[model samples]
Target chain A: MILVIGGAASGKLDYVKSLGYSDSSISDGFIGEEPVVYNLQALVAKDPEKAPGYYDELVGKEIVICDEVGSGIIPATREMRDAREATGRLCNRLAISADSVIRLVSGIPVKIK
Target chain B: MDFLLTGGAACGKSTYAEKLVLGFPKPRFYVAAMRPYGEESFIRIKRHRKMRAEKGFETIEKQTDVDEIELPPHSTVLLECICNLVDNVMFDDQGNMYDVTDRIISEVLTLKSRAENLIVVTNDVGSEYSDYSAGVKAYVQAIGDINIALAQSFENVYELVCGIPVVLKGELR
Candidate 1:
């Protein structure tokens, strides 16, 4: 029930490790079990349609990491736009349900919840 | 009272502002400050309108000259953003940068005085370290300047990070 989010390579993993999550417990996406730290962005990118279900399962247990990909200039291509929208929607859902939300900026963790 | 909401792009400032406005007394107005001059802007404006379509907000599209908008006294008003208002006043109308910040301050003060609750939404445009065009840089500076002024003037100022509100000034309530 923790959401760790930031821009690409903003040290999301380092912070997750700081929390003592084992590497083996982490995952790129869900596979019927909650990873110690799940990369929510990768799962959304792999199949945007599965994001809602992943979120449903990960809502109250998994520690999720998602990249902040919706900021800056809006995308011109429909595909990129869809990806951005999907990421934003999923993050918003997690933000609401997660007990804690942390935003990493330059390896610094700023607690938002 | 005035409430200022600021955050990076797509960081849920608008949605947060919407929720704030909803908590106040009605005759709620959403003051949109973007001109649909190009394809991208047109798409953005349409999307914004659709987002607030069900929020019981009577949309007022005014890119600049916010002081010109007519509102009933004691109504809650949400100025969608200050960044776009500065952009419209500067690049869109070729307004001088030196005076743009002052003008926005005056307009915002005027708007604030006219409402029971004024929630101003703005972006944290200068936080990014990327280089931008001269015009874009000027716009960023203008927004930063106005945001500082707003932070001082408003009783409540908040910055959203990943959809969580951080109070910079007054209490959230």
Candidate 2:
């Protein structure tokens, strides 16, 4: 699996597409059931009970993309804060197993793994 | 070695900080500044941090007056998230507001001098441009100024991207 993470407008999707994965192959992590998963952050935020290990199913099989959270002012609400912190913790296991890890900064793809 | 680690929320600053400290000798100290307020939030955040909880280290809570913290010589220290410390010191026990930049910087420096490796994890809250109130604006500015000053003092500085350390000042060990 390939893990792609960056802030908003970092061109994560474009970088993934540049790797030859079609839009059809990519799935919305919140709704779609496709092979490549995007928005893993939202999916985890939607369900606070789900752990990072929950994504173990995608190991070596899906392309994951998410927006980096938790860097700014702590959220005003409790729910939002929990979701923000959960995004990083829940993805730890998947990050370790990812075949390739990419971070998009200013629309430029920087390979971390 | 002193490190100033800056990264977006949940970009794995604590995880990376732990990795850096684990490389050093024993007697690791985790200086956390988060003050528990919301029960639900605490439980949820606790669940998230469980991964790092059991790691070999001693936990210390230094919400304010960090200069008062004392540690054994040659120990490694990881102070997770300065945003909380700034908030704590700014709003005292009576919830009064004041400028805490210089006090925080000086106190943190004092704390750094006591450790062999001081890995300070801080947030990057200056990116979003919003019409925040005077108090919010002041808080954000204080954090930014502290980050800039600390980055200059720390030997190694990094901004984590997706949990990966991106060198901003010195080379990774």
Clashing residue pairs, candidate 2? A52-A90, A69-B9, A70-B9, A71-B8, A71-B9
> Where is model 1 chain B poorest over a 10-residue stretch in terms of lDDT?
B90-99
lDDT of 2: 0.80
lDDT of 2 by residue, B41-156 (tens): 47745853684577777888777787898888888988877888997878767767898899999988998988888989888998764688788889999999999999989899
Which lDDT tens digits does candidate 1 get at residues B94-150?
545454899999999999989899999987766544667786676667778899998
Minimum summed lDDT over a 10-residue window in model 1 chain A is located at A29-38
Superposed on all Cα atoms, model 2 deviates from the true structure by an RMSD in Å of: 2.7
What would the per-residue lDDT of candidate 2 be over residues A17-105, giving only the tens digit for each residue? 88898889887765356777888777887876674555666674568888777666777776787788778765556677888788888
Tell me the deviation in Å of residue B19 in model 2.
Answer: 2.8
TM-score for all predictions? 0.82, 0.87
Best by lDDT: 2
Candidate 1 wrongly placed segments (more than 4 Å): A7-10, A29-34, A37-39, A42-54, A57-61, A69-85, A105-108, B37-47, B50-56, B93-99
